[model samples]
Target: METSTFVKEIAERFSVINRLHPTELLLPLLREIAKGSPVSRKTLATVLDWPADRVAAALDQVPSTEYDDDGNIVGYGLTLRETPHTFEIDGQRLYTWCALDVLIFPALLGRSAYVSSRCPTTGEEVSLTVAPDGLHRLEPASAVVSLVRPNASSDIRCSFCCHVHFFASAAAADDWVAQHEGA
Candidate 1:
């Protein structure tokens, strides 16, 4: 693909991914996680001064919530538990569901961030820094990010298998698209 065309497509995809967000009730919890501390359901309940059951019920309403075998909330929304998309800010280490989450979360948290993720096809590590302004120190400056929304019109939910991945090159991303259905 042409350089200009690829840049435009990436910008468009980032817009979509940026708009994908969790519900209002879960936003604070996510921000807390972004700060590097993993919040438990009980902690959230206590912090909000709400009953534990009520907090759990509210969490159930968000599709992004992922629980561990012990039923602890390990991830919610774009946040993951030590995944390939590592988002580091303020000495905190956290994970994101897709590459784009690394790109967008810094702005959401009102702080600068350093993000690292592997190219889905090549497994080459890509790293960059993001501030409210934009990206900087991006290794493989030509690298491209991939965003797939199974349902563009629907609400953002973890159940939806939308993907936000990274690729070292357009050809690499195209190769992945050919192998995956609906990519």
Candidate 2:
């Protein structure tokens, strides 16, 4: 398959897996699952293939964490809810918006609830608010600004999260804020 097609497919899968599991073990879990599936392993290893011994070694290394008891091979992954669906590198990136809450806060100084940039964990933009003592944890962007109500007038797409807040550089975020003051 073409690289972009594969990447997009992987990204979609990652977003699914991430809904259940945390991000740290996403790749390892992917490798473990890939090893068993007939086409899944072959397709993934086609480009990002690893040596057989290396794959075995990595699989062995995956269970070393202290959180879950390491007895069954099938258990112990990035699960937050039930058994986790392992994610590949692409999956990890797809779920990154879920993890980058604090990272995107600076860009979210002035945000709205309806915009796609709100954090899923908090259901709002991760923003600083005045506390009785001083600055504390952030509130979701939604709490700050009401989202534009969906209506027949606008074409709205539902996504896992609203706006994405990745940065090539912090200076770039600064530039973005400077250029789009009310955006």
Candidate 3:
């Protein structure tokens, strides 16, 4: 598929996932998580100005929400924990579940980010600055992002996010795409 087509498809699939949950709360929750700290339910409720029970119920609809030992949210799509994809904003280091999250979150949070991730095949680092408007300072100009169609019934983190990655170049991703059989 063409690059634009692939991007559109991936975006659409994620949009579907978003529609399955309460985005009114999810978007703000994501912004809070992006602050590079684990967010407690009480804190989230206060920040959102919603009831604690309402916050708890909304959180239940979001899958793959990583929590700290104290039950504080550490990650959803954007996270405080370490991952292959590193996203830095406002001098704070953070992570994302996948390469696309690095691209997607900037617009969602209305902020720019410096991103770095290793190519799964070449083990070479792929780095870039992504703004709410577009990508910038992408090293290795030929760098590309890998994507997969997510299975709606499965956990998005495992089925889709884990497979999506940054590649140093198209050639570096060819073997991985071949092995994955539909990326």
Candidate 4:
């Protein structure tokens, strides 16, 4: 697939995983995390002039939210502390939960990004430089991108539960697909 098509497909698939509804506070918090800042729940509460419990409750709606020792939201679904999807933007090193995240974040952030990840099946590293224009410096010219939208038609939270894996070859990805029946 062309880089733009690949990126769009990944973004659309992952769009199912997002804030349940428009809230006064949750989306802003998540967007901040998307910009690579670790935000303290308490600070958010204070700044937004919202109750602490209200802030916490809103944050809980976000997927894959990782907290620090002090109850700060260190990671959200689009950003992670440790993961195979590493995004290097400007001078900072950010992380995402999966390969698709690395592919799509540049468009979301409206910034150029340098991303690196590994093929789950072969463990071969794949890297790309994604800009607002397109992808460049992509390694491993041919690769298999496996997209699993588990429970897509169900009421289950698909975004948090879905999987997007990359592989060095179609055969390797097919092997993975065989092992994961539902997902």
Candidate 5:
């Protein structure tokens, strides 16, 4: 498929998945997490200015909400834990569940991010600087992002995010795509 078409299809899938949950709270929660620390339910409640029970109910609707030992959120799409995708903003290191998150969150956060991830097949590094408007710099200008149509009924992180990745180039993704059932 053409790059634009592929991006649009993937974005549409994400939009559908987002609509299933309380997305209004997502931006504020994401903003708090971007401050470089794990966010507690109480802290999230404070950030949203909602009661703790309400915050918990809302968070329960979000899939793959990772928590630390102390019950703090560490990964929600944007993460504080290390992953294949590294996202850095204002010199603070963060991570994301997938390549798409690297592209999307910079705009949501209204901040530029330096992103680094490896091609799943070739192990070659794909790095870029993304601004709120668009890509600022992309190393190996031939690089491309891989995407999958996820099952909406399943956990989004496992069904979609785990399959999405950055490739050094289209050619580099060929073998990997062939191996994965969907990409």
Candidate 6:
């Protein structure tokens, strides 16, 4: 077969490989590819229990690969770097890989309290006024924060991070705060 034909076949095979919805697996695959080695379609097909032609079809469909000016395939695939706007709250950062931290502050505050920052992490851009006190000031204040949120309706929760750590509505937080004033 001609060089161009061979390359085209490789591209097609790659497109088929993409059918695996291979996302998080990208890093490991890229690292292996970077070792100055070539990966065989057969190997991937065996691992995925897919036909080689299917793999090639998936790869050909993807525009993610790189090609030379002459339209020859050069490389394929990339690795995951980072997600946009990963959030941090109350000195702790939320991660996709782990279970979420329990929301303990609001229940502790009991009555209510007002937060200026929209929220601890989601950045939802909400404003809440709580009454009485979540925990009656049982915990000493070290750093007080205000509003922050990812977007609108964030007004319902932490304005910044957008985490619905608390279970009260804007009116609820307000009512609680108002009812237990000076407590």
Question: Residue-wise lDDT of candidate 1 within 124-172, one digit each (tens)?
Answer: 8888898867897787787887655344432344323336677777887
Regions of candidate 4 where Cα sits further than 4 Å from its true position: 1-27, 34-37, 42-53, 152-162
Candidate 2 wrong stretches, greater than 4 Å: 1-39, 63-98, 101-122, 125-183
State each candidate's clash count. 0, 10, 0, 0, 0, 60
Poorest 10 consecutive residues by lDDT, candidate 4: 152-161
Cα lDDT of candidate 2 equals 0.32
- Candidates ranked, most accurate by lDDT first: 5, 3, 1, 4, 6, 2
For candidate 4, the per-residue lDDT at 110 reads 75
Candidate 3, residue 99: how far the Cα is off, in Å = 0.2
- Model 6, range 1-183, lDDT digits (tens) per residue? 465765565455435444533443343333333333345666545555678786566455544443445443333432121112222223322211100111222233232333332222333433343333322321113322222112222121122222323322343344333443221
- Candidate 3 off by > 4 Å: 1-12
Question: For model 5, what is the C-alpha lDDT against the true structure?
Answer: 0.88
User: Candidate 2: minimum summed lDDT over ten consecutive residues — where?
Assistant: 148-157
Q: Encode model 3's per-residue lDDT on 1-183: one tens digit a residue.
A: 797887788778878887766778767788888877899999999998999999888888777889999999999889898999999998999999999899988998999999999998888989999999989789878999887877663367886889999999999989999998559
Q: Rank the candidates by TM-score, best first.
A: 5, 3, 1, 4, 6, 2
Per-residue lDDT of 1-183 in model 2, one digit per residue for the tens?
Answer: 465765566466545544434344335443443243222323324434665454444434433221224322332322222211112222221112222222332232222111123332233333333222333444432233212112221111112222224332344345444553221
Model 1 residue 16 CA deviation (Å) reads: 13
Comparison by lDDT, 2 against 6, better one? 6
Q: Write the per-residue lDDT of candidate 4 for residues 6-66, one digit (tens) a residue.
A: 5675456535533353246544554577656778877678768889888776666654567
For every model shown, what is its TM-score relative to the native structure?
A: 0.74, 0.22, 0.90, 0.72, 0.91, 0.24
**Pairs that clash in candidate 1:** none
Ten-residue segment with the worst summed lDDT in candidate 3? 150-159
- Evaluated with TM-score, which candidate comes out highest? 5
Residue 167, model 5: Cα distance from true site in angstroms: 0.4
